[model samples]
Target chain A: MTFVTITFFLFLAVAFLCYFVMPKQHRWLVLLAFSIAFYLFAGWEKFLFVLASALIAYLVGRKGTKSSLVFGIVSIVLLLFYAKAGNSILAAFQMKESIIVPLGISYYSFSIIGYMLDVYYKKIECEKNFFAFLLYMIYFPQILEGPIPRYKKLAPQLMEGHEFSYERFCFGAQRALWGYFKKLVIADRIALYTGEVFSNYKDYSGIYFFVAVLLSSLQLYTDFSGCMDIALGVSQCFGITLDENFRRPFFSKNAAEFWRRWHITLGTWFKDYVYMHLAIHPKLLKLSKLAKDKVGKRFGKSLITIIPLAVVWLLTGLWHGTGADYILWGCYWGIIIILSTVFAKEWKQVNQFLKIDGNSKGFSRFQMIRTFFVFSGARLLTAPGDLKVSAYMFRHMFSLWSFREFFTKGALVGILSVWDVVIVIIGTLILWKVDLLQEQGVEIRKKIGQYPIPLRWVFYYGLFFATLVFGIYGPGYQASDFVYIQF
Target chain B: MEEEILELLSAEFPEVDFTASDELVDDGLLDSLTITGIIATLSMEYDIEIPYEEIIEENFNSIAGLASMVERLQEN
Candidate 1:
């Protein structure tokens, strides 16, 4: 029942229809039923983990004590830990593996932890209704891959019944249409090329490996953000506005700015919960002061940024996965961001020394390109799914241009046919142009709305049929799951 | 007190306009980084420890808010 399937759409149609027909106060009941149905379709075992987390939060929220807050958070983190690595630990103990990693445990675990912290800090009144808490915790749209809702904002909206709005429904359907186009047409097409190149890294070199690295980055972007579009769009049809997760990330000019725009919800979650908490802790503050008196003021100030950022990045890496490559990936970004920030004055000085206009459009384009390659470097680390294969790809990446080989060989990557390559390129360009328009603050859907009904329907049906016909779904091209769902 | 603190902060972060808005944090004038910088700066200058609970937007929204927090911390 992934977003890329007809079954999910049928389920979605039923949910959306029932939602509008139910009595105003009873609409949430329909949502709850469908939400449970969606989870049950996935597996009943996964819901037990969600249920336990919800029950812990509900009990701690009702108790409303600091100790319960500690208890709740620790209990939730351990539950998440077991789901992440319990089997491995059990294997080491000569024990049978018996933990079931629930779907979207990473997403909900963070939500519940953040909710508990907010309640203890008196940021929001504790949620009294266990059912409402459960609904927010396991809301179907965001439960799988999340924008990671804040409790105060999403809980009330979940409980409140929304009247049907024609404009909203149109906007949502159009958004989902775009999502399907990206997921089916663009991402899966590129996946056909990248999957083969990455899996058989030994056979490719030079231009092939280089192109694979670049496409893998875009493959992830479209796949994950495509899913976000589906989730947010589906939620919006019911008058719920989930927080956005991507903001034209590839256009960012540096690693720091890139993170600010990419996977934005996850970054904000860490900033609020981990970075801010550590930065303002009295002990770290005291340590910084002592360093100032003992060593130097600049060194002391650097500590404030370095320590928290390192911890956040490490935890961010761990949250992504408990892998050696992911940890190094964390350190990779961490080091770049820390160095750039701590030496921001020096970076500006170097740009000045090189006679580069830091703010000019051309220089900004250069910076965007640099950020892209820097991002591709991080992708190179993780995309291979193994450290040694990544090293082999890196070492043999620059042997020769081999344009003749790439063209004269069996299409691209020995698997992608000519039409597949054409579709990927054309689809990629359309994605780029649309993202560029949105970057410039153009409301594309609104522009389409302003067109006469006949033309608008033409564009809509054109996209719909385009996805149906061109989407990669035949033999050997499976509809890949949204990339972020595994996280 | 607000005047003195504003003068000091302006000297430290000359690029910022402390008087631009009463809702600096709410209005996006102060970000998380700038807020952390302000904490480090005030902690060093006034020799006061700002606790975790005091790291809210209300305290860092404007120089006036910051001055009050600093005064309260300095007294304690």
Candidate 2:
């Protein structure tokens, strides 16, 4: 069930009540029961798959010693591959119909694999309690989309004694309300415009298509990060901490920094589990040394680093979907980042040598704005269906056309009002400011809470009321699903 | 030996102070890949094989903890 649905809130309230009312030792059992029930409520067919996977992982993890842990690891990996890569495998089998992916399979599979790997490595001891282990894997708050919880981080909290706290509930509710506002107001509104432009790219030209791409990026960020906020806020009510997944990625100075901020858990997962391992390979090291000696230090670093980055980005693209466009999108990012890194030192030198208004604040601000547009242009490649369509869109975007006609279009104006655009810009700025403050080690919620009751309540009520009045909700509007859920 | 290890970390990540009591893994000071790098380096430099299973946070919780693990491996 969606977080926005009335049924979900009803289920949450009932579960919350039962959980706090239960005796201290039995609280975990209450949570486990609710989690299973919730999963079954969403889809009964998929519940079986989740159970089987969890059981297999737990049993193998418990039985296998460190030396024999490969069996458990392999089993988990194969299951994950089968579930996640089912469509590709089915295509190979010459199946015609679209293969149904089990909901949350990608997320929970990773969590299960991470748990098994941690257990095998003895980073965390194997949980003898089956119920607690099951609860960790199937926790309802995180089951749909995840801040994929690590066993070491979450298991203790599951086992910990609980007492209902008014403060925690208030904080979680406020956060959830804010998340809903982002999803309904900013993201959904922007999606209306982007959806129209992208659906008929051939019709739009010049700045119209370019504007859509820039807006699509914002819509995506708000939609995906909004879901994460809801997930985190819901989990917080249970006193379970899920990882913060996004950090104002739009404000990042470079593509690499953007990856660090966006879908943080997934990026870190790839870095820890894939990229780092390849980087430290004996073959890679030897090649790095050879290149450095034969060519030059600059070329060597570029060659060595760029190869791994390319592979990582290629996998990242493929992981998003089986589409060629996704693959191209991934490579597009890979090229941008690699080139940026390659010329980084030289770029700095050029900046120094030219001294072209280098000291002026206005010049630096202009450069930042230029970089943002450049990044958005590269991201347009991510939206098209194939290379042909992508090229067509690019051609239209650059073609010398009637600028007056584009601005005067009624459909464009109808889809996104002047006030709606203004609201999106303001909302994005506020979100970025909050993220920047947090990055600098400031706790925003804590500071906000510390404000006098009248001021704090006013801010809360204002946010809630604005969401109620301005938020997009109707028969035709599909609650835009979180983008990363496809992965 | 501990001072040498600290020196290596200090050179690698100059942002933080490497200390005897710091919980590298638990406190998020050092990520999993960095730990793997340290393990690989230690294996090569000391002619000691650090088993993957033994690369848990307990062994590398602190400088003293890591030193003790290395000392034990040397004894073996």
Using TM-score, give the best candidate's number: 1
The stretch of ten residues in a row with the least summed lDDT in candidate 1 chain A is A408-417
Tens digit of lDDT per residue, candidate 1, span A1-487? 6787778889999998999999999888888898888888888987887788899998998888989999999999998888777776888798985778888889989998989888888888998888888888888998888989999899889889999999999899889889889999999888878888889877778888889999999999999888899899999999998999999998999999999999998999999999988887767888888988899988887888889999999998888877788889999999999999889889999999999988899999999999999999999999888989889888889887788888977455467888888898899999999999999999999999999999999999999999899998866656988877877
Model 2, A317-340: lDDT tens digits are 766665677777788888987787
Interface RMSD of 2: 5.0
Give every collision pair in model 1: none
Model 2 residue runs over 4 Å out of place are: A65-75, A83-85, A88-96, A281-310, A335-351, A354-378, A385-387, A400-403, A410-414, A436-442, B1-76
- So what's the TM-score on candidate 2? 0.84
Model 2, residue pairs in steric clash: none
- Distance from true position, residue B70, model 2, in Å? 7.1
For residue A453, what is the lDDT in candidate 2? 96
Cα interface RMSD of each candidate: 1.6, 5.0
Candidate 1 runs further than 4 Å off: A90-98, A410-413, A474-477, B74-76
